[model samples]
Target: MEIDYSTIKVIGFDADDTLWVNETYFREAELEFAKLLSGFETPNKIDQELFKKEIGNLPLYGYGIKAFTLSMVECALELSNYTLPNATIEKILNIGKNMLNKPVELLDGVEEVLEQLSKKYRLILATKGDLLDQERKLEKSGLTTYFHHIEVLSDKQNANYSKLLNHLDINPSEFLMVGNSLKSDVLPLVNIKAKAIHVPFHNTWAHEMVTQKETSGKKYETINTLRDLLKMV
Candidate 1:
């Protein structure tokens, strides 16, 4: 669907898979760590335990490879009768460290569109992630300057979206939520009467995926790439 960009004041974007690659490293690390502990437990069982820990501890630790590593290592140790030693801890820690150091690869045409759009509208970086990890990724990705406000949210609930819109001096009708997840980015904005453009991404973390209700209640725009958003907004 087409949008009149003239009416859209602030264009919001999700950071991780929306702009640059993330979550892949976490998946990779989990698989490798599971292999390392294969003697103790199956990967499926280990992943189940890790998923449980992630869901139950959502209030404690939001997101990051560090937490994932800790949870996996802790659960593995418990499951395996503490077979993992100090050396194992170091190994896991190094994996997370390597993830941090991995090159920041922005998705195709992210810069071109953001650069094009920034000149016209008030741009905001609206993303939910582990605060430290999120900030570092933004800095490294070289797209921070395009945004007037950068909000690092814990989660994108309706309350979170409402507070953010108010803080930016923008109303729901004037906002356009652009991101990958319908659960976090698109649907939450829809709850508040904000227009949203959903650009789907592969490899959605279990926590971020949501059921797609067939009814079209609010203004919903779906596209394949970040660059294509230019056509609508």
Candidate 2:
């Protein structure tokens, strides 16, 4: 699976861990409740319970911070069963605010790689999560000029990928999906008969960590840093 970088038109990037730090904020939120909530529930349990409750409500509110924060707040209230005070809700809100305030700390060499890549390929940003949060980070990072299109989807499934390809009017064989999540980025691209480069992140959110066979990993190329992508792309 050799590629001529010159022929690659659109390079789609995953936002969270691939470009900047994300999971740290989520961890920080859980840690904020460790002292008070740990007596009643483990940190992992708290996150899982919140996530489970959120999943059930996703159909109603959809995705983004409005929904995510609401889910977190709702979960906290549910587990505490009105026993939690106003201060607890305030604490969760503060944590959510902090998560929203995360700076766009791009990974090492991300800017340089994107700058160079922009000269050759039509870069596109394809991310899922809060649209406003994503936009704010992108603006602060000043990476918007490099991208021709910015796509913030509610979720990245096979249908999302297929629809994107159709909208772009590009064949799957001509596209390359680059991101940190193997489940969301690499395998999904491979499933669509497209190529993907997995750039592993040091910190993977519990929900995003992926496990696949060595054979499955073969279709995907791995790189330690975004700069390493130059070798293939």
Candidate 3:
């Protein structure tokens, strides 16, 4: 389907995988976490339990490395039946720290796409994670000047996007969001009658994965790379 971008006055970008590398580090950390707890459970079981812990903690802790660290620490204690060594707990904490300190690696063509699109439309960084960490990544990214606004949301649901558009004085029909997660970036905007474009990253978190049924009737466009934006919009 050919969609029109004529009414799109503002564009929102998802920070993590959409702009730079994110989920890859989480995958690495999970492996490290599994190895640390291998004595208590098989790697597969450790992975499954850790995912449950992260999802269960979402309501209280929200998203980001800090929350993931806490979940890993808790998982360790439980998996070891409260006999987990203090040293191992420390290792898990270090995992989160190392992830936070990882250098911000921008995706291919990110700067070029952002530079070109910023000229014709208002761009905003619409991402969800620990506020400080997200802010840190943006500062390190050196692409801050390209965005008109930056939002660190608690979650990316329809209501969240609706509130963001209202606060920015932008009509839903006049906004377009581009990102890697269909669950967060695309569906929410489509539900709010806004435009969305999916620019998928190679890796995705299990929690962000959506069923085909959910997206079967959703209206959005998918592009293979960020560079495609310049030609589309």
Candidate 4:
């Protein structure tokens, strides 16, 4: 079956790994966190527990470096049997600070793709994370002017996308989303009768990953690079 873009009036782009480096920093921070707690638990165990902690805290903390930092602190305390040193705690805080302060590195062809697409379609940014952090990265990326609207979503699900489309006064068939996360960016839009293009990043956070069974019969196109979007739409 052929997916049509003829009715697409708005093109939504995901930030973080879609437009810039994100998961890599988290991966790096996890490694550092594991090293900090190596005395109490092995690196592998620390990694597993931290992932669980992050997921468990999602409802309360939402998402971002600040939330991740808190999870690290809690995990450390538990892993250390509440005997974690102040110095180790401080190091954990620094991990989050460093991640927050890290530079935004845009993927190749991002600007080129946005510039071309914006001319023919209404471009909007739809990303999920801490509002301030996403705003800061957008400012740093220097791609803000291309977006007609910027949405920092609490989460990306079918309902969320449906609400967004409703707010825009557009039909579901008229919106198309492009992102690296199939779970957040692709499936929701697809499920809502909207179109989506998957532009995979090199690394995906564990939570963002979907199993083959989840994508078995999903109708979407996966491109190797953002540059490929130029030819498709």
Model 4, residue 231: C-alpha shift (Å)? 0.3
How do all the candidates rank in terms of TM-score, highest first?
3, 4, 1, 2
TM-score of each: 0.93, 0.90, 0.99, 0.99
Model 3: lDDT of residue 102: 100
What number of backbone clashes does candidate 2 have, counting pairs of residues 3 or more apart or in separate chains? Answer: 0
lDDT of 2 by residue, 33-109 (tens): 55556656788798788778777887787665667678777887777776888987887777778778777788899
Q: C-alpha displacement of 114 in model 3, angstroms?
A: 0.8
Ranking by lDDT: 3, 4, 1, 2
The residue pairs in collision within model 2 are none
Q: Per-residue lDDT tens digits of candidate 3, residues 142-214?
A: 9999999999999999999999999999999999999999999999999999999999999999999999999
Cα lDDT of candidate 1 equals 0.83
* Alpha-carbon runs more than 4 Å astray in model 3: none
Poorest stretch of ten by lDDT in candidate 2: 209-218
What does candidate 4's lDDT look like per residue over 1-233, in tens digits?
A: 98888898999999999999999999999999998898999899999999999999999999899999999999999999999999999999999999999999999999999999999999999999999999999999999999999999999999999999899897988889999999999999999999999999989888999999999899999999999999988
Better of 2 and 3 by TM-score: 3
Superposition TM-score, candidate 4 onto the true structure: 0.99
Number of the top lDDT candidate: 3
**CA lDDT, every model vs. true structure:** 0.83, 0.80, 0.95, 0.94
Report the candidate with higher TM-score, 1 versus 2: 1
